[model samples]
Target: MDTTVSVSAEPEKKPPTLFERLLINRNYAFMWVGMATSRLGNVVFDTALLLWVATTLARNAPWSAFAVGALIFIPQIVALLMGTFAGVLVDRWDKRRTLLWMDGARIFIVLALIPASGLFHLPFPSGSDIATFFQMGCAFFILILLGCCDPFVNPALLILLYDIVPEDDLPRAFGRGQVLNNLGTIVGPPLAAGIFFTLGIQWCIFFNAASFLVSFLNFMLIRPERNAQKEEVKAEQGAKEEKKAGFVHELVEGLRFVGGNGVLIAVGVSLSLIALGAGGLNTLNLFFATDNLHATPDIYVYLDVLYGIGAIIGALTVGPWVQKKLGVMSGFCIPGIVTGLLLFTYARLDNVYAGFIVLFFVGVSQATFYVSFGPLLLKVTPRKLIGRANAVIGQLSTFAGMISIGLASVLVTSPLHNKHLTLPGFTLGPIDTIFMVVGLLALTSGIQAMATFNDYKLVDKQEETPAEKSSENEDVSQPLISYVGRPGWLSTKKRQAAICLVGFLVCLLIILPVAFIAPSSTAATVTMSYGHPATGETIEGMECASTVATRQQLRTHLTLYVNGHMAALPTGIGIVSPKQPGVRALASNGNLYCLYPLHVFEADNIIHADLPDTRTYTLGQFFSVWGQPLSRTQIADYKADAGKQLKFVVFDGKGNEINYTGDPGALSLEEHKTIVVLYNSPDVHPTPFTDWNGL
Candidate 1:
């Protein structure tokens, strides 16, 4: 028997998943996990800190909120000041050790703040403007200390990455690092919001402190073995020789390397301008969230959440395409333009939901610009000069940001602080004015970036058509007509990227307005007849739920009527009121009053809202808008102290009365319908509407 020997085809190899690919390297995987843990802490700390400043502390002095924001950025300014020197120092040190020590130091520093915050409040009179400023000062000092760690930590981390990963894997390693960072960003805000609203600011800070410890532990576990130690020694020896070359000499060498590079100069200038605009916008976002959008702490968290998601999308999907399709410089220009337009749109939008969409797109554009710019900077610079080039860019951007924030603080607080300004050409609020200026700056930066792209310098021009394909051949070296050529169609990679970029933006444009844009004229009528023992006076009008007054003012009024009952837990929801401390805390000073989009108890005695759609809204939502609780046992403190249970009777437009107890807050309202919230005895029932003429 003749036996034919056959070899089976090799089993197909499956591509590694993102996590698998990232974690394949033992060191990077540990660092990434640590980074994620650290990010969660940062998010929680930031949210709690901001809420503490914006709501808990700076409730009276709104400007102090800006001060809190400005103080947080103070560390970035410090980085700009010391970044070059710090880079030089970082190169001399063992990066892994440096990272470990820095993380350990930060954990202790953050932990110390919990006690420090309380201690700082001791000397200052509580609930006073002075106390607010004192609190802000404490925050500023803490942030400066935190900021000081970044320059050391950031460069060390970068160096460690180079030391651990092979040259071929650097890009993948950095990409993984960024993905984890964004992942932290996306999850942190909402988590912080949940904890802040429930467990309070202390828990948030504690969590953040713990995160740093986790990161430190992960760094401790990174073992690069003998090769890493050797590289570190080599680096230190090189650094020592470079030191003998003199600091000025080394600085000049790096600067000279960048001097001839046109792309670096263009990117630096463009980014500086963009940073200035961004700084102004960033300064205003918190205020805009509370003041303009009338958002509570929970809603403000969405801004960070949505932006993080958009950034992730941009980084993973859209950014690569945009960067490839548009040359790096041109790509920067596109995001700048789009960002400017989106900011303008954001300034105009009145709805919080719409604002979320605008912020999301803005985030996408920013992410694209950042990812594209970094690679280009790295690609063009000599390895030796890279640190200095980055430092220069960082300093310039920081300087611009500082100037813009200072200017914005002044403009928004005093000089241009007005609800509306009737200038010769335009009319807008002080916030809107800042937004307009920033938008224009971004646009200008985009134009400047676009102008910097040249075929001979950075971008490769498409080869000239062969003589056979040309209409006619010019005589050898005749002076060609100098015509500026537009960039040719992008490569297939870029085209695909562009499609993804446009897809997100287009989807945002179509979906948001359709879902949230309400008819300006379609008003809803809300009538509230609430009083103990049948006072019979109906409190109606837009004032009850109108979000016209400042949040502080609305909250003050909300506290007066809703009182302690607002924070009480729903009885029928399988829990008792005051059982969970978190629920109890949420009821008090949680910005719950801001939930009311319209003032239901205005002098008009009828809450009028231009709703997006005609869907029936629950009475609970109405109570939420009124800054009151609606549950089985309570309705805005009505007879709650008297130990009386709450009840409700609802009449539809057709005079069909529906009586319900144990949380009738879910009851729906209709045109010309009547809802009576009764406490204790039900002797005085609500009369049904016989005529619909009064609606």
Candidate 2:
């Protein structure tokens, strides 16, 4: 075997201007447009679905927040496996057709959502309290399926772009692609919100499906000549001999290639770490809005818009400019540093306005990173190997995301003895921890980029044909091993079971505390009386009590009073009580009276007596021995039941009443006690109730 690298002759022609260049290259433009359109549709659909799940469908579920994470992570996990097979198929078959099929499949899958929405109208399965579960479940399943297919779609498109674009134009092509991608970021969220508001979430899915169909049609229009030539050459050469291999082998080959190429390896690892940090921060943004910023649901759109505007700026300005002026590594590094600093500063910001400013910069940095890296990766990879290379890089990045998720999950939810002290002033929720982690990773990636600036020079110039072919084999070597090893942690069975168990336990733990501490204290009262208007006769009785009892206790206590006979009266005569109480005491001359406390748990108790006769009962009827004279207002309202007496008992921490009935659900025992002390305490209020009933 010849080991020496061979060089291809350099072309002797000047490159066209960027605009002219893109217009002349139909393949690059088509792929760029298709990818951008597809991505926009995806974001719109995903944002809509997420909003629906969070606000309408799974809104009440304990695991609602986890649904979003599952949507992101499940697809990534599937992508790792499917992406490898997709790479193999793209290499072995027509790349354009592979992409076409992927897009077509996505269109159909999203269209299926139209019927799935019908499930929402179905009578919920009997015994289920949360009816939206089945509908949301269907959505989740569809999203997972989409995730499975996405790996093939992304890599195939990238490889196709590499196949059609000349080496020198690759960076600008990718930069333009990044601009289009950022344009998607700009359009997606607001479009989704608008569609969701006006047309409902189902229509967003339909629109996304339509976008996929359009992208598929565009893919079909692209010429397949270059892909066909590459496949024909490979077919003539026959299958390259391999030392026995599996998925792990292919995966490792990709890993090894990335590892061997210092520039590629640094880029991959740095970006992975950066993703770990940035993804965690993004994950916590919603929580930050609600918890820290005190934002309601409606405000999220404005927040998203702020971030989107920054992303647009980065994509349109920083992204293309950096790709042209600085090498990709420097472009990535600059943004990485800026984003890190901004994120770190965000941690210090207590005001929501400040957070918005920081997040905007964060969005810009993220856009810069994406645009800069895409072209850099394409520059190092051969056209034929781009699919596998991306698969491997994607797998690593996904793995990094998974790790970040796990870490953030632990940091956010884990109970710490000194949680308040762990991060001073800021209530360190899961999001706070995630932001800190992401910031550190970004700083590390930025520093690493600065350290490895020299290595990127090797990627500036294209190699000769023989040497390029050799590098392709080298690039593929590590990925082969990564593909076969099937990283132990990525096992679907283990991950699913573990996630379910942990989620279940977390739900149980969170619910238990709420169940223990969430009942409201109630205070209610009722009154009844018996008297004759023509004769000066009256009979009135009153009792006051309070209990920290359950609802059953309150019901039973009221029932007993309502059922008991007073002055030989029938049980249903004229008992007046709250809904929890029942009826028994007699009524006469349009007057009603019954025994009840003015306060139930924590309320003021008032007592009054009056006869139905043309005469008003004096306070002496109830508290005749009291020395203080009753106020005229109090005298007019007082009423007495014939041959009945009134007595007052303090329940202390229990509901109590005087002359007036308490408002239902008025106050807790603590509040009543505070009010009572404030009103009656000699030190605070010199005027006290002269007589409990007369006051």
Candidate 3:
């Protein structure tokens, strides 16, 4: 055959859709489907929880708005506490295992809401604020657990994406993943609202639980491709890096740097104001839907669907153009100002369908702002302090959100709940005033951001060593946008690779305990199965049995540390008045007020197990009797604040101690075995007390 050369333009290959890409790789397909399924469940669960508490449980209560607002803020508080440590945790653990466990935990958490919902339906405190408070506490319990699980899931997913997908296709993979996530949010609302209305909140919860189980199965099928030796080398490198800089130290440096710099501080403050207004809108939106908009709860949930749809449109449409044409500062700030104005308009709107259009734009503005925010931060922040700067801003914004929600809750619950203030064009009630005030704040932040960063430019100083670099790293002149679009996308975990340019921005933008009558530091109460003032009433299946046995019964040692200081184990715990510590004139229904199965004879830490049988009691039983609240995040008056954790250790008779990771309230009070409860002291490995010293 003679050689014949035929030159023709090569046909261009079309890019594969998300489904087509999935068909090529089994592992990545599993991961993609798993994430989508779980995300859908999560959105539905969140919707159900919010509506159930706000509408069904606390329907007409004074602080119904506050309780509704707390649903969002409380989780932010938890993130502030543990989010920093998540990166380190993810680096250390098996990514797949972590994913599976997180899904499993959330499934259990969603199911628990069923019993939690029944707390409101209880006849004893029906239709009362007390019952609502109790239900809120129960709901908080689940939220806290889910919140703790969330931080680990996100980072782990990012790493797993790197592992299972081809490096070149990572960006498209993540972008498509986001599309699915937004889709889930779009569907989740109406689905949750439908299930919530037709079948009840229980069905909504069960549906979420089933979705998680489905996600779990898909993840289980995923066999990640890993090079064993390479992983070992990677682990060693990670450990070495961990030793270089601690989060606290870096965060302090970042705070100092940010505090001194005008632009950085404005950036931090502006981000906070944005979070505040967004949260405020959400917190009051339910009430706005029913009261001003004159819509039902079913109609109210659809607003989220609209918001999600608008987000997709904004991200695809105005998001890139804003950065390209308006510059980073203007891009981030302009949306803030627009959103502020929209919030004011929303405050005055009466038609349900019209309000929907307004909410859709609000989502659009927020998404546009978020699109530029990550780049703006990268441009302004030094390469080294990137993580630290982000952390500080995240913390500040979270606090702002928490404060806005809290303040709104207080204002609405006061005499202003029903009071209305009419302006020239519109009327202002609690919801209206809140929307206006938050709107003004957002507007102020946007204006300040524009003023401060209007002429800001990126500087190239990556070559300078940390010791040589100045605090204000604005020496070399360059366009801010020029700094990010470069090839060095595979930077650190915070900066993320090109794969995460959009996903990172989308992800970055986005628990409380109980109170009791006891003299805890705080006033939040824990939820109980049943409320009883009688001596022998059982709580959590542990009977308030007699502790009056003359002979020495089982005595378990108890110790408590609140904020690193040892709090005195209060006197007369589980006792009806004072029996031996002081004189008691107790006669209840022809019988003396008996001691609970777990009771204290003195103000000491020894918890006497005076049960007639050998049945062991839980620390929770003693807490219920003592009128104190106990949970992983809370103990009596003490709470685990930001960057702190609640932890405990259980000791056996052999002087062996194991750190207990489960519920603090569920700790068993074995004879002579000391148990220590420590809040906000993760570093101080507390040991159980050995010397009972004769009770």
RMSD in order of candidates: 14.9, 16.6, 20.3
Per-residue lDDT tens digits for candidate 1, residues 1-695, read 12332223234556667766757578778877777787778767876777667655554342653565575568778877677688878988888888888888888877766754553335432233344456667777777787788889888988777777776788787787777777777788888878876666667878888899999899889987557666787788778675566778767866765555555666777788788878878767766665455465577778877888899999998888987776665666689879878887787654678889988998899899898888777656644566788867877787888887887776665544433433366445556556766776676566555655542244221233554223233231221112244556763234433533453354344323322341211121332233221111122232222122222222211111122121212211101122232221112232222212222322212332323244555556556544556676666555465565555666554446666654566665444355655455445434442211111
Over 4 Å off, model 1: 1-20, 116-125, 228-244, 256-260, 379-383, 422-427, 454-456, 459-695
Which 10-residue span in candidate 1 carries the lowest summed lDDT?
567-576
For 153-262, candidate 2 gives per-residue lDDT tens digits of 76677777767876577777766765576667667887887887556777898889888887887787788455666777656546543433666776676666665655
Better of 2 and 3 by lDDT: 3
lDDT (Cα, tens digit) per residue for candidate 3, span 44-67: 888888878765665444566777
- Tell me the whole-model lDDT of each prediction, alpha carbons only: 0.59, 0.53, 0.67
lDDT of 2 at 53: 62
Residue 624 shift from truth in candidate 2, angstroms: 39
Which 10 consecutive positions of candidate 3 have the poorest summed lDDT? Answer: 510-519
Give the candidate order by descending TM-score: 1, 3, 2
Models ranked on lDDT: 3, 1, 2
| Model 1 error, position 113 (Å) | 2.3
Candidate 2: which stretches are off by over 4 Å?
1-33, 115-120, 125-130, 162-172, 226-268, 302-309, 315-334, 350-352, 370-393, 409-426, 448-695
Tell me how far the alpha carbon of residue 604 in candidate 1 is from the true structure, in angstroms, after superposition: 24
